[model samples]
Target chain A: MSTPIFANFHPDFYVERLWDKCIKCKRCIRECTYGVHIWDEKKKTLKEDHTKCVGCHRCSAMCPTNALIIRRHPSDFREHALWTPWFIKNIYKQADQGGVLLTSTGCALPYKNYFDHLVIDACQVTNPPIDPLREPMELRTFIGPKPEAVEVEEVNGRFRLKKKLPPVIRIEVPIMFAGMSYGAISLHVHQGLARAARDLGTLYNTGEGGLHASLYEYGANTIVQCASGRFGLHIDYLNAGVAIEIKIGQGAKPGIGGHLPGEKVTEEISKTRMIPVGSDALSPAPHHDIYSIEDLRGLIFALKEATEYKKLVFVKIAAVHNVAAIASGIVRAGADAVVIDGLKGGTGASPTMFRDNIGIPIELAISAVDKRLREEGIRHRTSIIASGGIRCSADVVKAIALGADAVYIGTAALIACGCTMCQRCHTGKCPWGIATNNPELMKRLPPEVAYEKIYNLVKGWAHEIKEMLGAMGINSIESLKGNRDKLRAVGLTREEMEILEVKHAGE
Target chain B: MPLELEVTPFHYSQVNKIIREHISKGEREFVLRGVNGHRYLFAGVSAEVSAVIYGTPGLDLGAFMRGPVIRVFGSVQDGAGNTMDHGKIIVHGMAGDVIGYAMRGGKIHIFGDVGYRVGIHMKAYMDKVPVIIIGGKAGDFLGEYMAGGIIILLGMNTIYPERPIAGLFLGTGMHGGAIYIRGKVRENQLGLGLKPYALDSDDEKLLESYLKEYCDDFGLDISEILKEDFIKIIPYTHRPYGKLYAY
Candidate 1:
């Protein structure tokens, strides 16, 4: 045999099999597509090849008996806290191929989660907690630009309202399903998210992959994205939505574009994206025509003109260092809403360096943008939607209490659909069928089941949000929006508290 | 019969409202006079109406328009026919920058010169081919990142014939479109991933077909415009960054 092109410096996972319980049933050999388990016919036994395992636990879950276990491989090199195994392995990977390291999912570094640092306040004697079961606790939210001042006119001696307000999307809950493109995930996932959005009276974003023809029925709950690729953009696509989102940058891979490999551009994906079957779909880093804020205004108005001003338009940007200024520019550009994606956001695929080493956390970005817009006296001109790293209902509550009109959950929604966060989304062989385009793998997730699970997850979170609001003695979610006074920080520096516009605990 | 609506005070939103209201009430033809810088006129109006404008209209004229015919007697501001899906915009005078930006379908015919970044990100799908025909010279970065469609720049009434038909960095990042210029193009002016090819029979036929309509509308001689040799610029590959990644 010829020598291998690249060296396998180390195995990331280790497989342990119980000899007494295995019984040589060969279940793992059949279930594993990574070839981690092999059948030794000469010895009439099964052998474990730990080198090929990605620790997805596909075979372990499928095993009839409790005989297989997979764990992170122990480090064998000389131990140094600074030179961790991951760092050394990454160096070896780059040294071998001289290529940029690629990874998927959110940042892996163990950064401090600000959501954990902030605490929510409850009512005491001055205000009484309303029982949600007996009293009506409103969770309904409308997302769009609010009128700074209502205009009135006298018609035939009767005063009539003359304010021409922008379109607003009403959701039963303050939680929304974030933008996840069709090519990055399977059709079943999109269908599930669409159905959930429709049933829950919310919106689901079609992230730059273009809306599938079959999903046109869900247009009432869909928000189509117009990214740099300009893929699959036509009159029908523009008309088939309640709103349009101009994707300036994604939080996970800020300042970088996306490259859907040619191998993943199957016939169905090619039709949706409007490219050739075997050609790579490359979304350039920046829109060639948009060199300034004026160009951005032109694009935003172009979409508005195309849709006849019937749908709201949003501009989604990554939360960079100057996100406050960027948000101000977007609002002044006449966008109906603004979406800020934090550094901890997830992606289908991103470079390893970009995912882990760029962007600020969502908490700081949201507070700063909110304060800046309020200071500029244009806070009511546009709505702000925070995304990235939202895990539970508490995070949502904290986000709204800090200043977000709504929160977008991508990874949380995926987890409800049976995702394990393996971070192998770029590999196209997802064991859980959450991020793969392979038909066989995709079939593992049924839309009906996924939809029910997602609906239940968001419904549960909505109930929790209502409960939190009730505890604060707030009857409506509108009162909780940008109410930073209801929150306090713990174990945070004075500068952090000042930036977040919150007070210290027990002060 | 065509209806008439005069817009004197120049409000962009009011003009569009009137156009939409008229179109909704089965008014298919309209004559809009005193159109001084009213942006987004006839935007996203889907009716097959015929509109005639007198004065200069503002930015984003006929944007996202579908199945309408708008003819401007005077020049227009920037971003005319921006992201238009299906329709026709005929301008009698010069146009501004970023003309036809991200337009997917329809036809825009400009009689005079246009500013920078014309035909940027103009794309085409199956059976829907967007076409832009400019009679005079064009500025820099023409057809930048153009995925699909056809752009023809005819140097008919160009003031400076010694200069190139288009400015520098023409066809930058163009992937799936063909741009035909009436005059010579230097190698230094061409952007990366762009190459000039000799006109084939198909290209000549396309140019003749588009120029015929343009000349007919502008009262120009098609035969005289087509007499000069043309150079075709096309992207080197549909997948420009295919080999940039490692498996």
Candidate 2:
């Protein structure tokens, strides 16, 4: 309602109804939640307001007669190199209403993505590649600390493990769904993620939100988070998850706290997050207790103590500068795993500046952290989970090759669940029902449907990852870890290639 | 009969393992002797059990504990009841910082002084209110970012008469809940945007209900603790930082 005329004049998307192919049905009006479509009785035709559309393409996909065309508005303006449309329009928005420029999902910037420049190597005639169809190619990954040494003893002519191993989260695929709180998305998405994780033998993080009562049944596949807000955290919620993750910061908005606006804090969200109905869930910027690495150690052990040391405990931080050193300290602080989220990490809502410009890319961070830990003789002590901007199966394979134990996908997971990345999540009126809490919009994404989509997505990606592994002549995913020799960079600077730990294409 | 477990010789893990083992075996009452800095004394004991600790216990003494009544005879360390869902923790002596950090339900009654940031981010829901009643003086940054619950600081009969009842930055960044100081509090001692108000009937009732149990926990007279008029400190807005940023 507070949208200024300057923003309204330039539509972000152009929604057109093909008159010749139009069936004159009212399906567009019903499908759109942004009030973009209206049926005129006099002309027996439909009209649309392109400015109201967020480019979700829901109507285009659902159009019965395929009469809808949605694209970026072709409106032209004299281009200024520095002040682009978004910059100029954002200035207008702030001048009129003075609210933080907010957005959802990953950063939309065109920063140098190392994944695009780096290519995975394939086996030539000299090395025979294993066919995934015939040979057993292991993709199984265990996320936790490994013992310093394994002591085996002979038992009735059979070798047996002599000591009890630490707890671990076992996953068949190296890809996982990143943390998206129940309040940020709909309950349907959380249920879907949980069911998918259960069905895929993987894990889905619950973000900082406490576990919903209905989701406790899928505890074996869930990773409950403890953040600064400490919301909805109790013994039951901690025990309900397979692992506990201390959410120090997120990739999208590093160093800042999360604010689930009061409007989106519905009754069920209030119940799940353990706050009063209609109250904003403000997670504090810092865990007040964790002021130093020792303090972090205290909380890490505290969680371990709470769970009686049965569940693995992980620490997640954004891929900021000096991330490698930060990760080293975290490992020394006794975390079983470290989750590094890059600048391209997605969020339900984040200040645009922080989302785009705050953190480094996951590619560099994972390489740096893995190399540092290995140099420090502690790489085997913990696992590194890289995330942010993981697009397809190739990206997943590259991340693992760069020394990540696995990767977490937030935006990619949502895209599979029908998100078009329209950047309207902060408005809390998501037309695709992927980022809204409204009951009607949430109904569009049933739990079963979301589960099916995400399940197929991961399943398909897993097969593709196997194909990549087969081409690389690697029999197991673990054998590919930290194997930067299998990667080559094209058109990257020497310094960038050094940071990425990949060689030039010819070399 | 309470089972006696001397936890001085074994590691915290072994001590805690034996303690939880008895708990799962339906042992409701426990007596931990010589508990010299043994951490996680009753961690994750969800059943309705009770423990009597003799010596000083280490960090997170009862973290994530549910429905357990704990009575510590000696002073306790930081994170005494960290994130405990239900039950009571009664410390006969004093407590360290973050004694009840982020605890959602149950009550913590410390008989003596407490360290800084004692009740940081403590929360409450519906009828399940988390309460922390400190008998002596408190340190700085008390109740910082506390969302919901009640923190009653009774600065009566403190050892350090030279110091104020509470240090600087009291109730800093508090968005919910009320802090009842059993005496006058200067505005300078409170955090920015926090105001002190006179107690209303509901505040009086809430204080009375918790103080009755508090007085019994420490064997103190309820009338003596309530003799002084109390002032309350609360955030004016639930969202203190709501209007901070531009869209």
Candidate 3:
């Protein structure tokens, strides 16, 4: 027999019963982006290379015959009890050492005690919930520029600028779609977001991934991203949006390069991006030119110059331990807004290890950053947008109450558009066809339908947010931001409570 | 008449103003020589023309191009082919960074090494196949989430002692077409999501035709170029990203 290349092999592991159910249809092999399965016609059997599996579950999900039953590799630790303990011990060592976990994409860490760690409070007897039907609740708030400081300037018996700032450029709601590039998802997804944001009177982000020509009509409601890649970036691209966001880092792949592999680089995507086909589109891990706060200002000014300062410039950073320091720097950099993505933010694809590890939680990260900025007295200078695991309205309320001007929705947006949280987005075989770049699959999702869903989701969230605010006796979102006095820590230690800057209820 | 716009002191003003007017007037062919790190050289040129840039051109060269042929005699900087469509782009020297971001169509040839994410989200249309060829080493994610078209990485002679010098995450989420990496690469070193095999005779012939055309363009000896073995990465099926999710 030929030597088995793979280290671990078991003959008994292969179920003979599965062969009887095999219909000879190659759907699993065909659908699997990783090419893990091969049909051996001569043997009347399907050969699966377990090593090649990225655990996307696309194969089992796509199987028409129900022949393929993919389960977690069955553990035999009890049979080989001696080696199992060492094996388990080594994994802890790896975790303690802070070494690379070598995962594929998105967070795969075992869900920690999130509910216990974070807590929200509501005034029970004193604050009566305002009726959302009769009473007017304000979720409306501008995301762009504010006055440099709380000062009124008089120029020759008149204000310096003739145009009065349109009372916080009122949006009907607080929820907005987070930055997911056109390349990472599909044009249909972009159109869906654009249409949805427009309908909802909110905004959708065209991530550092370039904007397709088709979605140009929804520019008024769009937040065009200008990341290190600079794809689809031009005077027109800059000017053709409500806001321009400079993407510094992503929560999923923090401190890593923004890489869109060549295979996903299709003609339409390439045209939108203005890059060549089948060439890796690399966004540098670090903005090499931006060495200091002064350098960041130079970039900000350059963008301002290019766009004639009409568009709002936002500096986006992954919420790290040092986010407070970074946010302060961004404020000094003269940015109108700051967007912070927490560790749980989603990606089309990222190293599994990086996604699970390497960043601070949104709850912890936000409170710390908010406190840091406020302490530095720069909190009001720039607007704050927080992302990562804002799955529902409660999270959004908690986030805004914790000092965020607004919240950016990522995983939730996907969920609204029929994303099944399969976590197989890195492989371009998203069955709902939302995340992959595959032309055939992307066509499955009509832009119109997808857009409507996003619109509905955001609208639903907005209504819920208004309700939450009414219950808290607050009418406006702005009044709720950084109002952590309304919230309290549940199971946190004294130090943790201090760090979160919240007291226990009834304290 | 072939016009020469020589870049001096890293200032692209003299050349840019003229090219802007020339492109506005719909001039087809222009040559820019001695471009030594001049930034934003030919950005947002929406003409169906060709400009051959000699020497290194700095950041965002040929950004948002619409049916324009841009050939770099030497290297170019960040955002080389950012959102370009319907033209040919050739880089003789190594490209600095972020070669083709979300490009739709057109052919880009890199004679030397290329920086990361060569074709991030490169899509294709019916008959409008976008082709990219890299002569030297490529950075990570060679063709990330590519919906269609062809991406060829010819790992030519490298100064680095590493035998198989290719990028990480090669052909990740590649649904359609092929990625040809020259030379045998170790499994771990290649760092691709997909495992590819050696090219068949028919595919080798197709690659040879392109290689021949590349040789003619850059004046390379065809025999010498074909000396190295080529590995062809084909998705097991045309629809690698088969319907895997549902509402």
Worst 10 residues of 1 chain A by lDDT: A2-11
What is the two-chain DockQ of model 2? Answer: 0.54
Candidate 2 regions with alpha-carbon error over 4 angstroms? A1-5, A19-26, A38-51, B188-192
lDDT of 1 by residue, A1-507 (tens): 954434364888889998888978898887776789999899898898887787888888888997998988774779889998888878776766666777788988988889999999999999899878889998888889898898999999999889766678888888888888888888899999999999998999988888887789999998898887777666677789888999988889999776676656778887677555656666778865466788788778777876777888999999999999999999999988899999999998888988999999999999999999999999998889999999999999999988899989999999899887878777777777778788987887888878999999999999898888889999899999899988989999999999899999997
Model 3 lDDT at residue A386: 86
Off by over 4 Å in 1: A1-7, A15-53, A63-68, A95-98, A123-128, A149-167, A257-259, A288-295, B160-162
**10 residues in a row with least lDDT, candidate 3 chain B:** B238-247
Compare the candidates by lDDT and give the number of the best one: 2
Candidates arranged by TM-score, highest first:
2, 1, 3
TM-score of each: 0.90, 0.95, 0.64
Which of 2 and 3 is ahead in DockQ? 2
lDDT of 1: 0.85
In candidate 3, which residue ranges exceed 4 Å CA deviation? A1-105, A110-116, A148-170, B1-247
Q: Model 2, range A1-507, lDDT digits (tens) per residue?
A: 754467778887898778898887888999998899998899877898887888889999999999999988999668889889988878877776677787778888999898999999999999988899899999999999998899999999999999988877899999988988888988899999999999999999998877778899999999998888888788888888889999999999999887787667788877766666666788878887788999899889888877888788989999999999999999999999999999899998888899989999999999999999999999989999999999999999999999999999988889889998888776678888888889999999999999999999999999998888999999899999999999999999999989888999999
Query: Model 1 clash pairs?
Result: none
